[model samples]
Target: MKLNERSVAHYATSDSPADHTGFLRLWGGLGTPPTAGGAGRRCWFVLKGNLLFSFESPEGRAPLSLVVLEGCTVELAEAPVPEEFAFAIRFDAPGVRPYLLAADGPAAQEAWVKVLSRASFSYMRLVVRELESQLRDARQSLALHRRSPWKAGATGRSKPQASEHSSRLENGHSPSKDCSPGGSVEGRGSRLSGWASAEWELPGPASLLLGRGQSPVSPETSCFSTLHDWYGQEILELRRRWLQRAQGGRPARENKDRP
Candidate 1:
């Protein structure tokens, strides 16, 4: 392929549009570097076994290429330029930065393990705690309001004490809709409604962004195989818990609330 003095074109956009992400397969082989030369020019490193890595663009884009660094771990689809991409190249590329350095094998491995473990445990605790607390609160509310707090089954379906300036205009007691996560409610009539409504509200925005801010910048690279087994097991546990939650918190149809 030939650049033929045609400069590489670059598009500047904040978020990538999903459909246009497959621009790498456009090349059959290495094209000439987009840069002519110098301190921050583009160049091609190597291409073999369907691994077409570039040194000028973000795998296959423009506007941010002193040198595009692209590589495909998986061949058929487009290669992924990881978030640590530029950092990896700057250290490994020899010329990107004079003072940059790569760590030894063991150090790099330890760094990656530390980062992945932190993420796994953080998410594990967050998700587990949320579900556990919600279940506890709902159960407690039911226990408290099982029949009637002040009286026995002799009252049958009685309401809690009422007031003229009460939050519950329709019912004789305050509404349990706003009890939130673990706040117990007491009243037989709205017990089911309280739990259903709370669960409905709980799961939607209960998100926990595991690794916030920027991506990990250890400057050291290591293959993830060492932590893969533990990561995989934890992921399976999270998935199983999520599935159970989905079944448990399924929304009720208004029409089906009859019985």
Candidate 2:
């Protein structure tokens, strides 16, 4: 395949971090079979991302060869010269001869094999996609957690307001009439006091345990606890009114009846 020599030359000389770099013995010409009795040449090999570049020396600005480490496998191979630590990069393409290379030692051979095996664009893309999926799931979990308190507060407040309105209707009073000027000041004050009491009592353990500045929902005070407190307050108010009637004291209805 024809490569853009200018781009390849720029990348070869770029200061970008390399994945692996070392001097290795390269056998034969690029894509050609090994010669009958010729020894391999030791060249400076640099692996930057998926592109492998070989230079005449470590400081060489020009690259002698370029190998795209895609659709390829790196495996241990027996070199022509015995005692040489060798490996071959075999590509999947037809009529493409494998690139035979020998490292200086066993450690270098193993390291080159490991790095080359993972140096494909496909492998890097897979890693990126996995990380993105994990990030998305984390964001979703955080959004749900943030909305939980507001949802619970809305549900808790709605139930109490509905029950309060129903109780007023059963007692022969209109919600609109509660705001009228004809109502006694004492009655209005008492109603306001009840509302204040309920409002104060709504936060329950959140206020007591976490202090006034803390949020209304705490670990100790969940939606269940808030609903329980509201219902409990209603029961207490009903019992108090019943006791006042039994004692023959003036009930709140008498205030509306008076001039």
How do the residues 1-259 of candidate 1 rate in per-residue lDDT, one tens digit apiece? 5542223332222342321111121111223332323122233322221122234445544332222222101101111222111112111333333111122233332232222222222223334444434443454466466442222321322232122113123211112223222333222112212222222233322121223332221111122563365235445654664575567762354224322
Error of 1 at 18 (Å): 25
**Worst window of 10 by summed lDDT in candidate 1:** 70-79
RMSD of each: 23.9, 28.8
Per-residue lDDT over 1-259 for candidate 2, one digit per residue giving the tens place of the 0 to 100 score:
6778998789788998888999999896495457566458889999998889999999998998898877676667878988888778876689888898999988888778767766765445334433433443464365456533233223434454455344323432221232132322231112222211211233422123235454322222235676477457545655665576578894575435443
- Root-mean-square deviation of Cα positions for candidate 2 versus the true structure, in angstroms: 28.8
Please list the C-alpha lDDT of all candidates, in the order they appear. Answer: 0.28, 0.61
Which residue pairs clash within candidate 2?
A: none
Candidate 1: misplaced stretches above 4 Å? 1-119, 148-259
Candidate 2 residue runs with Cα over 4 Å from true position: 29-38, 147-259
Candidate 1 backbone overlaps, count? 7
